[model samples]
Target: MKGYRISLIATAWLATIGVATAYEIDCPTRINIKSDHPELEATPEGWQVSINKNRSLLLTSLGVYSDEPVKLFELKPEIGIIDGKKHDLTWQINSAYDENGNYVKCSYNGEEVQLAKKIDPSMKSCWAIYANDENQHTTAKLICSTSKLQEVE
Candidate 1:
């Protein structure tokens, strides 16, 4: 009975590891980010990333309250970068929605910051990620992805 329980626990742990690996974000090594462009293009004169192992980056318009979209990526001692500088992304999602939503709340980041839309059960996406260089607000580093808009009951 002891061996059987141990085997079950090991299997469950392995499954959890697999799930975490599936959620890893794949970022480009380099891309040209220009203001008023359509999307991120491969260019030598663009932003380059020096990814730091075992770290996460939650990048927002740091030190100011603005409507820039939030980005959540893995980080370490170093991570994402842009404009010839290593990005020092330090913001974290500390809340969600309800009493148990504190882990994803955008409240602590900035007062005037634009918050991402919370995912609902009915929401779905194309799974294809994109980015455009349009200064809809401040910077043109917005991620341009398509998703189905569901009608809330």
Candidate 2:
């Protein structure tokens, strides 16, 4: 009976917390983790996220070779998954363009991140850019594809 009770308690806790991979975000620019985790450092190469003493995590723009800075704003418990919890942080790192003018909004989500870009008025393309890294998955990598996105009107 005692063993069964223990099992039930464990199951209940798991349900409430859910799975770590189960957590999702649309644009995860920053990740918030609990204080219990190791120190998070933003190296020039990339971000060295110490999930714990046992493992490490790295968050970088999906790329092979580029010159975009592995942009990191703060170093602390501010964003991402912490103890099966979601901590999402967003910053307008560079909003001068947006302030200068307006463009169509982007819509996409990822496991731990999501970046939305507006449709460039002149280019007639919906380019999604994060920090200095533009969406290079399908585009021409560094340069924003001209007709990748349909013109919205």
Candidate 3:
């Protein structure tokens, strides 16, 4: 009878642990930038830049070429004012892959931004851009391609 009770208690504890783990949220990794405007730095790995409070860009080299800086990702504000009018900004990933596989994942304020997986064959590159607001949220692409990327309007 004591062994049966111990088994029951262990099973209940394991079930609780499983439930807690299943509900856990997976978060993306965030890079910390120290400057507010045009913070540019070059390291052996590659280059990083923060254009302003609303924009951050990173370029990493795979060492294919000596001087080429590959564009990895960019973060920008979702909304902006243009001509004294409010305008939505666009986010784009010009190139997201190479010969191996998908190579780009963009994020804003610590959240991953969904990008279209459309590869352009003619050019040896992939890129994308879009815009959103503080209250708006976007989805991510399941597959990475360059041809399917669309400009935000």
Best-fitting candidate, measured by TM-score? 3
TM-score of each: 0.19, 0.18, 0.20
16-104 in candidate 1: lDDT tens per residue?
Answer: 66221111122322222223333446645766644343322222331211122343431121233222223333222212322221112
Most lDDT-accurate candidate: 3
After TM-score superposition, what is the CA distance of residue 115 in candidate 2 from its true location, in Å? Answer: 2.0
RMSD of 3: 16.7
Q: Provide the overall lDDT of each model, using Cα atoms, as 2-decimal numbers.
A: 0.29, 0.31, 0.32
Choose 1 or 3, whichever is better by TM-score. 3
| Tens-digit lDDT string for candidate 2 (81-122) | 233223332111223333332222212223233233332333
List ranges where model 1 is wrong by over 4 Å.
Answer: 21-153
- Report the alpha-carbon TM-score of model 2 versus the true structure: 0.18
lDDT of 2 at 130: 41
Model 1: residue 136 alpha-carbon error in angstroms: 28
Per-residue accuracy of model 3 over 6-115 as CA lDDT, tens digit each? 99999998886522111111112223454545433653456555345543322211111111123433334244322233434422223343333333334444332322
